[model samples]
Target: MFKRLAKCIAFANIKGGTGKTTTCINIAGYLAKSGNKVLVVDFDPQANATSGLGIDGTTIEYSMYDAFLNQCQGYDGIPITKIVLETSVENIHLVPSSLNLGVASMLLQGTRDKTGILKRIIEPVKSFYDYILIDVPSDTGLFMLNSLRAAEQIVIPLDPSIFSLEALEYLKTYCRDIEEMSDHVINQITVVLNRAIISNSTQNSSGKPSPSEEIESRLKELPDPVFVVPQSLLIYRSQQEGLPISHYATNTGKIGKAYEAIATHLSGNSNVVTIPEREAEYAS
Candidate 1:
């Protein structure tokens, strides 16, 4: 049995460009800024989450790929603690990914317990952090399967498009299948609407509901509340500069607040409290 002390949450979507990595990093930044220890496991071979937090994957000697392969070969995997690197954000660390991780699926193909590899790799270090956020690749393969099996909760980022909505439905089915196969039951699944355009005039111009409105309408039939992260130049700038929105702008900034609200909600805090000391801790 896996003993998990940290809240393992995965930001996963089958479709790309849904801001999965963006949401994972910013929320983790806010959580870490709040003084909670957080670890981000960059499960995607692209390593966007690794670079977005200002770490270069190429420079890392060992990565998630090594850990997964070592575990599969019945060797004590590279201890997750040894692979963890501190990010620019205080209290946040990362287990970066490399292009070699792209072949991880193939490596695990003939393994006896392929789906449970990640859970075993993370089990030893799970007690060391408050939250462990896994950034999964945009696919329904073994890599994504391991992420889903390892997480206690799943956060799906939707881009407010028909394709994204369809992908959500597919993910829901996949989750059900996973539940049937594993002992771990994913108790909570949150849907976050990213890059939402909230303009009534824009909706009227298109003779249809705006992206936000359309997503809201679709969400009413779902079990989770849709948190909105508005489209903003500041958010784009932050990403371009390889910083979390909270690090790029003050917590009071519109984009920053959106992430904070989601972070606070996920943390189950009824009141949002600002830790003044942490504000300057990671300030650029």
Candidate 2:
């Protein structure tokens, strides 16, 4: 069962370009729009989530690096509250990432508790929000390990591609290893199928099963509930405009509604919302 405090979820996939940052931004946005206090930690060195939310990571005074170093040294180098910045989206905040975060990970490797540093950094401030989403990088290094350690739940954004399907298996194995290592059970794991093409025909031009069909079949075999976000040009446009799909487009639209459904699920409203059935059919 999830703790009564803020729910910390990490959007993690060891494959890049699977829309991890995009998922983090939109879900946090919609959740905040729904009147929940949300904080997005741009844990990825790429800082895409920071930039996607209309914040210039380069200009941020204090990034995750400061917080990590502070925790490692046991000195109040900088509080996470100071590092957090408000976004244009009301009720949403961010701890912007920096290029220095890559260097910090290297430095963290020498620390006694590298994997637990992020958890330490987050412990102080997690209770301040309703949801805290960490956008993790696409690597299995100490940085990714720290992210996994800090988060209570995982949200994996997967593209409907053959490579993504394989990556999902690898991620599951990785999570099992983490659970054994840390003795912390990740209570919930939700997979979102992004950039999916919905069609009545199961097969595509090559006559093999379409990506969505294959993904759905594979996901059903697992215990996790999967939600599908259809392929749409609105996503790109929203990114370009520095706004979330829920903000740039109407929440009732295909793309916006898909993310809204995800937000509802993440907000512990699973009893109030049927995510897999409603989103899958909407995508179709």
Candidate 3:
């Protein structure tokens, strides 16, 4: 029920080190490799997504900080398009982030229609790409809300942990709040269960389930389908080298294929929200 804005996806979870930024970067890379034009909007103040793609944040001339300040705060600053830069991955581009990004959230305080600022900034460039992937902070703050407001789909990159399970429950409620605030429902939600270890099927003497078994059992209750990403050291190696898993692993190994499977799901209609009027508009 989201308005026909753009193919925006917000990768969110208010939990740090859960592979959210990594998932967003690699998925954007794979989607681009598949011949679709992709733009990565690193809305996270930490700028992890920007550096993860081999783009140095310190050397960037323009960043998301400028876009929010200019577009939202009524200053005559550069357009969002001016901030978009070509990334190391082909067919993929980026609106890089900077350390100053956190300041935008504070500056926009008390402004009218603040949550919709990102939506309006992105609305002008909808036709330029097949998808726009936004990586927001791991906190339920103004930045997170703004990105979620602009997204049509939500991708939760969850690590298998008790704390992560609690975060997912909180995220479900947060998404509903976003729908109410944005005046449209988030059409699709997909969960990527990162770093999954499925070998622990045996139970203890007391019959208590293994951690993996318990997590899987809990995951089954969620309405959305879950994709499992196994625990791999190559993931860390790829990140250290500032490369996407597909590029580093050449889409051959287990970890690489797992992410590729996720890329496959995201490439299909099942991962994207169907908006009738938008399709009609595109048809014309």
Candidate 1: worst 10 consecutive residues by lDDT?
273-282
TM-score, cand. 1: 0.88
Model 1 over residues 152-243: C-alpha lDDT tens digits?
A: 88989999888999999999888888899988799778888788776555457766867666776777677665576767787667777777
User: Which scores higher on TM-score, 2 or 3?
Assistant: 2
RMSD values for the candidates in order, in angstroms, are: 6.2, 3.2, 7.7
Per-residue C-alpha lDDT of model 2 across residues 113-160, encoded as one tens digit per residue: 667888888887877888889999998778778778888889999998
Q: What would you estimate as the lDDT of candidate 2?
A: 0.81
For candidate 3, the lDDT comes to 0.78
User: Which RMSD does model 1 reach against the true structure?
Assistant: 6.2
Candidate-wise lDDT, in order: 0.81, 0.81, 0.78
> Which scores higher on TM-score, 1 or 3?
1
Q: What is the Cα-based TM-score of model 2? A: 0.89
Output the lDDT of residue 68, model 2: 76
Model 2 alpha-carbon miss at residue 247, Å = 1.8
**Which residue runs of candidate 1 sit more than 4 Å off their true CA positions?**
1-4, 74-77, 202-208, 271-284
